[model samples]
Target: MALLDNGVWSKRFFSGGWTDSALDHPVVEPATGDLLGMVGLATAEDVNRAAARAAEAQRDWAAASPQRRAAVLRRAGELFTEHAAEIEDWLVREAGSVRAKAGFEVGLALGECFECAALPTHPQGEVLTSEDARWSLSRRRPAGVVSVIAPFNFPLILGLRSVAPALALGNAVLLKPDPRTAVSGGVVIARVFEEAGLPPGVLHLLPGDASVGQAVVEAPEVRVVSFTGSTPVGRAIGEQAGRLLKRAHLELGGNNALVVLPGADVHKAASAGAFGSYLHQGQICMTTGRHIVHESLLEEYTAALAAKAEALPVGDPAREDVALGPLIDRRQLERVHAIVTESVAAGATVAAGGEVSGSGYRATVLSGLSTDMPAWREEIFGPVAPVLGFSTVEEAARIVNDCEYGLSVGILGDVGTAMKLADRIDSGKVHINEQTVSDEPNAPFGGVKASGTGSRFGGAAANIDAFTETQWVTVRPDIADYPF
Candidate 1:
């Protein structure tokens, strides 16, 4: 409620404190198309300053005892839970998330904090057998400073997912949240850690647009860059990081597929598909963009799915009964509508809903899709599910792998058959009898091929290595034994 002071929000944090900029961008609520407030934009110079401070703080923070670091993170998790109500409200207003989605995002953020707090005590090194009479051990060392660039949708969780782990691993973090949800993503995150007694300059949140994000990525002080967003942006970041020889971790876009086998329960699969495709208005990277059903069950599954999609309540997020909220902004709304219209013209059938009402669009089901359609090949980050019929499991696998994105896939059928087919699917994750939109704090979450850059973000092992470098140490009992 007090996120904006006098209709303006600050962009600087931690080392820089609350600083203003020459230009400010308006923050708009998607549900009503109203301007909530304005957030100051950070310049490239500000990014350099934050990165420098983070590098400086990281040395002392890394040298501190693991218990000390864990204590701060645990306290931050507690603070996050204590302010859940305000954070939820901020998420609804900033990201256009419904109550359920907003609450889930906040809960996930807190869970990440707690989970990452335990990383310090976890196994971060190993003792290796050496040929010589010396002790050889490999340990993980912090990468000095880490830069995290989060997207607009689910900003709170995604931002914290990378930030928490990097900090827990002894690296100072510089978080640049999406301009759309700066309050929920950047401000709230910084406040939680600051209140938890985190040392000054250990964490910094810079709220701005693409320019600021690029600045962070190009900054020499930032040794590791973790980003979650569209694939085009991720690719650019990966290329830039490679050119600069900096470590990059990217969680990019996905065109996930949900396969309904012949023996699958049509009604159950339909419900799961509806939730997977429409949750958060289908803005998630793991949203089910394609629905491939066996030819024998295509009619039954399509009808059931259309009914479920048609029944979802779409309106302002503030309404308790509203099951779906608007897109992030007018541009997203227009782009979604255009995708549906173009697909329909290309011989795709709109099975359920296709019209855009208010700032929100209806949950739509499209059938009779061809591989040539844009919706079939591209990632449709909207509440639209395209159903395609496959003659066999082999055909289904082909259809699923035809696209460039292979983030995740859901299989609804016999466990044995699903597991067998999952091995052939070119995805990073496979869910049996479940939806594609699934994630856990302790599981390795990422994608392969074009969906991502093959860099994982979750799980203790993955997080620790993602933000750290390996160092090998050897000790000899006698100095004369060494070749001096």
Candidate 2:
């Protein structure tokens, strides 16, 4: 495959249509600094048009039979399966994911589409009967216009995780994908909606930068905003939506922690911890940025983890042997660099891998970290793993809960010991014997505290709550005759 130059954008699909125009940012391979292709940039007018089209199509789409909606969603899953290789290629090229990581994300996306399709049957209503010649019932109705704003990390899967559920519930969708990987994966998803024989305008893909997104959020027609990204941007989107009195579902930033206890399998825990933090170069919201090690085991545990991190293949993301990839852009690289620099100034020791090569930063490990260091206090959002020493399991658990952001936490130790610690951590999700990466299409995923508001990607049950509104029907003919 030939690498592309800067100034060329590829539009896989859009509201107006597919147009491969030159985008603003040149798609560059992180490790090699090789240009791949340009991503399409959507303008404010584009958002307006997309929102209008979705609103126009929503009435009919919401009225479509549940069975029919489910069939479309099923077909989408099949289409995704058939095009798995192509999608994986795009993920590697655009998002800089290793082949294994790309494959995992694609598989998750397919599963989400399938799970979302089955939601119609799962969205059940409640029935009530009254003795005084009156009856009541409640049903879930579509939320009309749903605007899905996705992050770049898991471009395809996370994007679909939000939009698929909305579409399956008979809502018209306007998709605003991450600008970095906006071309093929997102376009392919919109194409799936089209292939499923969805009416025109039922699903609109507007790929662009921040201006386009701000416009989409401000549009009067877009009633609900589903967003995933950093805390600052998520807060801005929430404030904008609040101005319009619109509904918002946000899954924002995380500073996940991995606690290693004295009784834990040092080797097993070290390997899992390395991958959880360094995979995707630590761009994941659920990535374990903090390693809270028991004081008794801190030295040996850090050594084991440093070796595992050193052994990871840090080469081309497209290669099957590679386990780590480059930071998406220079901005992320700088952010990681600043956090590491600040930690060192605060007296944290760099244990391993803290160098920057081209767009990729070395998988970093820091020890002797104090709670006051920026790396310990904030979401590093990089491969810099900072280890903090803790005297007791209670202290370890307390340190994890002290962060303003409580998204996910990983506890590694004996089954009984881990569970006991887990009972005290104030995070949205907890993992035992592993890093904080658990997969259950039916499970709820989100954060608490400053991690942002609400939740998303939960199974059919929770999605039913997100995409639908409840209406209570009543029969009170006798009450009409009597005034208050």
Q: Compose the digit string of candidate 1's lDDT tens values, residues 1-484.
A: 4433433345334344666676677778888878877777778888898888888988999998999999988998998888888889888977999999988987888889999999877888899999988899999999899999999999899999999999998999989989888888888888788778788898987877678888999989999999999999999999999999998998999999999988899999999999999999999999999999999999999999999998998899876578889999889999999999999999999999998978989999999999889878889899999999999778888998998998989999889888878988999899999999988888899999888876477898889879889999998898745466
TM-score of each: 0.97, 0.93
Query: Which residue runs does candidate 2 get wrong by more than 4 Å?
Result: 1-13, 19-25, 129-132, 476-484
Give the least accurate 10-residue stretch of model 2, judged by summed lDDT. 1-10
Model 2, 182-227: lDDT tens per residue?
Answer: 7544666776667767778888887778898898898888878899
Q: After superposition, how far is residue 27 of candidate 2 from its true place, in Å?
A: 3.6
**Best by lDDT, which number?**
1
- Model 2, TM vs. native: 0.93
Top candidate by TM-score: 1
lDDT of 2 at 215: 87
